[model samples]
Target: MGWKAAEKLIRHWKVLRGDNVKKHIKQGPGHEGGIFTVEAPFHASNFQVLDPVTGKPCKIGVKYLEDGTKVRVSRGIGASGSIIPRPEILKMRTTPRPTVAGPKDTPMNLVLEKTYEPKSGKGMPELINILNDVANGLGSSTNL
Candidate 1:
């Protein structure tokens, strides 16, 4: 997808990760960050969650930076029964040896079959016209 498309998707999802550093500073003690930040602490490599069925602790996944550096996040239970943690520290684990590709020997044409409809025609035309103008401008400039 293009930049505009990706931006639209982000706007559509409206998933707020957490507050900015400034918000954290201004909010002071009682206000905990968003759900994602609260869940981060439980994501530490050493952190473990008890499995109700087995009554055993299961290790959580720890995410690393692109350079393979371990990310350190702060996680703590606050006075108001809130959990706080660094974004990097929280991670979720996936099943081991998950399927890389779909069923083997499947035809290539059937790879992607998902489609999404526009929410409304309100902003669609404007966005499309803007992009069309930009493309036309680029094409004309190249020929000049």
Candidate 2:
């Protein structure tokens, strides 16, 4: 949208002579030093969210459901009136995580084992201290 909008603006302003021009002249090594068309930063209002359903540019509109949860939908300019799903980029994980416990994970039996000692008069503080000691390499797995 940025480069396309800038190109459209420049074409529309062709009548004016070198006035209010926003262009890039490439320089330095590996650069042609010729005028290069680039994207021009524009106002947020001019930005359009692509309608996934219609595969066209659209204005985003919020719709409230009966549960009072708001959902984004396609509105105006080739709108398909369908709920807009979140962007794929946002949903993608840079690194995939394991769903199941791995070899490095603590055994379930050990994790479920109780370390509480009510007779010692130690409560959550004792558990915290044990965890801190383990993290600092002062405690063994047996202490857990």
Candidate 3:
């Protein structure tokens, strides 16, 4: 699968980050209902993953928390266009954000380069199955 396809699949999973929760919360009088506080259960510290082929970092997803702290939580990839998984999926999972000591605590720079290599063999079909599993898993976990 091409980079475009991989990006599309990754993008779909981005919603799991809980960035849109505030918009879904209802407003009320006694409580600041609309203003919901969403603590990122998982923090993505290293936003840019190095492409094996290009040597350049590909901007995979947004890095929450301005601090350079690794948080362990359920994490997934997001992309645009078609959905395709790399032959070797490099994923990182972490919890809550850590305390920053110095300037390094700040969010990492965004790598806007599209440096993904085209996937071979199982392409779109395999990607569909993977995405389905991810979607189902996300749905069930959020219910709890």
Best by lDDT: 2
Higher-lDDT candidate of 1 and 2: 2
Which pairs of residues collide in model 1? 74-85, 74-86
User: What is the RMSD, in Å, between candidate 1 and the native fold over all Cα?
Assistant: 19.3
TM-score of 1: 0.17
User: Compared with the true structure, what per-residue lDDT tens digits does model 3 show for residues 6-60?
Assistant: 7765654432345534544666777655555464322344344554444454544
Question: Tens digits of per-residue lDDT for model 1 on 1-144?
Answer: 899987665553423334421222234488755433221211134444443344454443345668886643322331221222444533655545655565665555654643334665453565566667777774443332
When sorted by lDDT, best at the front, the candidate numbers are: 2, 3, 1
Off by over 4 Å in 2: 1-36, 87-144
Off by over 4 Å in 3: 1-15, 35-87, 90-144
Per-residue error at 119 for model 1, in Å?
Answer: 34
Better of 1 and 3 by lDDT: 3
lDDT per residue, candidate 2, 26-66, as tens digits?
58888678664554545455567888877899988989879
Clashing pairs in 2: none
TM for every model, in the order presented, reads 0.17, 0.36, 0.17
| Global lDDT of model 3 | 0.46
Model 3 poorest ten-residue lDDT run: 78-87
